[model samples]
Target: MIKKAVRMKLYPGLKEEYAKRHNQLWPEMKKMLKDHGAKSYSIFFDPETDYLFGYLEIEDEERWAQTANTEINRKWWDFMADVMETNPDNSPVTVDLEQVFEL
Candidate 1:
């Protein structure tokens, strides 16, 4: 599996709302992610900065990327747009992190 990480910023004071939404992630959305090759997915938050760090292992990067275009994923993005930084398409504004060192 390929390990990946990305950084995303959240709107101020929406931490609880953000977590609430994710805690109730749609079943279809979760299945879509796994179908597209995602595994061991996790997200972390830094309360002080309102920044989110997402990590996941995937079978293939290209396949995982396809998850963004899925209907369930799009709905999830729209649901989250109001509480976080997102593009015009309602997709989260993310910056991929490079892996520099690992043991």
Candidate 2:
């Protein structure tokens, strides 16, 4: 398995709203991610900077790319765009983090 991490900037003061949305994540979205080989996923927020750190474990890292083409994924991105720094396609503006150390 591979561990992946990404960083994104969230809109100010929407921490609770972000958590709420994830807590009520759509079933189909969850299933789609799982089916695409994402075994585990999590997002952490940094209050001071409003930065979101996303982490995930996948069986095959390349398989995770397949989720981008799914309709459910597009819908989710569109829904979240207002609360995050996103690109023209409504996808979050994310920077992949390099793994330096792990125990």
Candidate 3:
């Protein structure tokens, strides 16, 4: 498995909404992630800066990229667009993280 991390900015004053949304994430979206090889996915929030951090492990990078092009993924993006920074296509503008250590 390969680990990946990404960061995005949350809209101002939407921390509680953001947390609530994830806490009640859609079942289909969760299933889609797992179907596409995503595991141990998690997101963190920094209220002071409105920054959101996400991490997950995937079995294949190519498959993960392709999965994002599907209808379910598009729907999820649309659902989240109002509260996050997203592109015209509604994908979050992600900053990839480089892993430097593991035990």
- Top of the candidates by lDDT: 2
Q: Which residue pairs clash within candidate 1?
A: none
Q: Report residue 60 deviation for candidate 2 (angstroms).
A: 1.3
Compose the digit string of candidate 2's lDDT tens values, residues 1-103: 8899999999999999889999999999999999999989999999999999999999886788989999999999999998999999999999999999989
Model 3: worst 10 consecutive residues (lDDT sum):
63-72
Q: Rank the candidates by TM-score, best first.
A: 2, 1, 3
**Lowest lDDT block of 10, candidate 2:** 59-68
Runs of candidate 1 with Cα error greater than 4 angstroms are none
- Taking all chains together, each candidate's TM-score versus the true structure is 0.97, 0.98, 0.94
lDDT of 3 by residue, 3-80 (tens): 999999899999888888889899998899888999789899997889999999899999888877889889989989
Displacement of residue 35 (Cα, Å) in model 1 is 0.4
TM match of model 1 to true structure: 0.97
Predicted model with the maximum TM-score: 2
Cα deviation at 10, candidate 3, in Å, is 0.3
lDDT of 1 by residue, 1-103 (tens): 8999999999999999999999998899889988998878999999899999999999998898898878888999989999999999999999999999999
Model 3 clash tally, residue pairs? 0
TM-score of 2: 0.98
Higher TM-score: candidate 1 or 3?
Answer: 1
